[model samples]
Target chain A: MSESYEATVTDPVSAPMTCDSNPVEEWLRMDRMPHIWCPGCGIGTSVNCFTRAIEESSLDRKNIAIVSGIGCTGRVAGYLLLDSFHTTHGRALPFATGLKLASPKTKVVVYSGDGDLFAIGGNHFIHAARRNLDMTVLCVNNFNYGMTGGQVAPTTPEFAIASTTPYGSVERPFNLPYLAQSCGAVYVARWTVYHVKQLQRSIREALEKPGFTFIEMVAPCPTLFVRRNRLGDGLAALESYEENAVIKNGADTRECDLGMGGPIVCGKFVDIDRPSYLSNQVAHLRKVLGDRYVMPDAWQGVVQ
Target chain B: MVETKKSAAPKAPKGHVVINTERCKGCGFCAQFCPTGVLAMSKGFNLKGYHPPIIADAAKCSGCGLCGMYCPDFAIYGVKNGRKPESGDL
Candidate 1:
């Protein structure tokens, strides 16, 4: 069957007001433009949403800190022109928590891949969520570890084949949204790169939200996931997301199981206001340490 | 209709279009398609030795993605304000 493409030019649903499209050069390191991610990789789209969220948040860039772990998605820290730390694998959350505790006013963000977050860093992920830290954690779930020769990750489907699993994976994948919700993350949402506008909106909301805000982006890893699964190309995987994903209100984890080949649920799964770890830490510190602590006058007394 | 003092000409949106230096070939398509006298050929050359377009009157930009969509090579992209959700503004 031959496929015909149609272009539709619909009238604006609202007024035709002009808005500024200024290049955010300061926020972006132009040298880092044309990123290192493979072509058709959804990490770029997620990165775009992240940068747009930061721009829209109007947060003080000087006061913002980004922490990332090892993986393809972890490289986001290097692209962003902010106070970022490219830390060891699966340790982004701990470093971000430290930064948040040191400077409560600073906005801390953690960017990692499914392998880094759900595999080796699984323990840290749950503990961090349980603590309700005031930070935005973006976990890019591409089903496999694209950076490390496409190994099967904790989020890989039960039967999906990977480099390590030549035949098929027998182990089931972790349900990210449900795990986060159960672990006590205050805000949780999931979106694919196909839903750019909605993903950007969710990122913005997550940035503004207090406590632990976890966003699981079901990104397309064309190089590994697609090639092995015979899913055509990267654009084909993106089209699949556009066709298979559904944006439903109040959608829960039970309805979006990857193992059962269910519809990809994309929306804000949970959002509730709660006191963050920093605030609670400060209160505990004051109560325990009392007023005995005083700022040192000079760096001479500090020991490395 | 009662005539009031002519309102000052509405200023166009600022910094509407952006050119990706890596993909842009300085084909002058953007300048050709620009309805307003905002974009022009830049004196400097890109890494590829192409004279990329530059915004002459940034204030006159209308945030239209015409240049971006028309470029043979998808070298340009636009991000308009207000239409994008602004976080922490609330």
Candidate 2:
């Protein structure tokens, strides 16, 4: 693990060389370093886990495509050095579904925020899970709409204060894991920013799952959510995760609804195998057409 | 005549972290998240007028890399003073 070199006069040869290469740089667009995320924001931490999972899985980097919708978490696709799509608001799941169907060999990942996924795109989320489409969806739940000011969202817990809910929200929030599991997601997991190792491990597992894998990542929105809720700075928010999170791996998703106060349940709740949409379609075509049917190559002509 | 001095491969340095002080945004995440409590915010300010973290105890560093994992900015990372592992080990 060493290279010998003969230094020339123009080499300056003033200082000893060291391995300055950073491990995180290889997976990122280094020129895009110093991302727009607020200081101490947890989205970047999730990005770290993502790159690590990609590396650990030993997948071909070129075949992985990242898709995102409009929001703070959506910026993940732009920062990664992969084939990424930043689609319209609340449309990441559908876009990813199309991409996955087009190129079955390519690994498609949809990463976006709660407001973008659960609020506006909830119908798409449920349908995609119901169809058991092959894709990984990572939702960063900051509990409110971070990009469009501190507005309340479908995932915002009841009684939590948002710019839109100054008097406290009377509406109940959706328990994402429960919703995903009920909608037929094959894999469901949740983790907070403080659980870095667990988050990374869950990403690795979700990447390996075959159909409709979903991970709910809770992060701190220092600028908007934190300020509006009177939650302390980003660091304090992580401290809160440490204090409030409870790991219950096999707990029923029905009882895991998170509230404004009390312990937040986090773990992998559902994992089971069933026929995926494309797989079932292929099976049906083979059974009906017999020798007449020929399987088409991924990314091949579908319109024809 | 040009003279070139050949130095033996540098010895493996001790495990320590180097902070890019200017890049820090005074988030205090490193100080709060360090498992060994080896980091603390310095009283001094960087050019950006933000307090940066400093190594409070060099002896406690095990190079666990939690600081780098939690840091939103790529301002901090772990430095290992050991032989590089074979390729494909990552």
lDDT per residue for candidate 1 within B1-90, as digits (tens), equals 988886699644633555565455655645655667656767676676666666666566665554543343335554353454122211
lDDT of each: 0.72, 0.80
What tens-digit string does per-residue lDDT give for candidate 2 at B1-90?
A: 879776787533244454666567878887888888767777777787777777776556555667777777756655443533222222
DockQ of predicted model 2: 0.19
By DockQ, the best candidate is 2
On TM-score, the candidate that comes out on top is 2
Model 1, span A1-304: residue lDDT tens: 1111110111122223222222333455667655567655778667766776776876777878989999998888988889999999999988988877666778889999999988888999999999998899999999999998999899989888999999999997899999999899999999987776688789999998888999999887878888898987666776678788889756876666665245788899999887777566556766788897443233123211
The C-alpha stretches of model 1 lying farther than 4 A from their native spots are A1-24, A259-261, A284-304, B1-21, B24-75, B79-90
For model 1, name the residue pairs that clash: none
**Residue A132 C-alpha lDDT in model 1:** 95
lDDT of 2 by residue, A27-138 (tens): 7887876688877688988887788788888678898999999989989999999999999999999999888877888888999999999888999999999999988999
Query: TM-score of every model?
Result: 0.72, 0.88
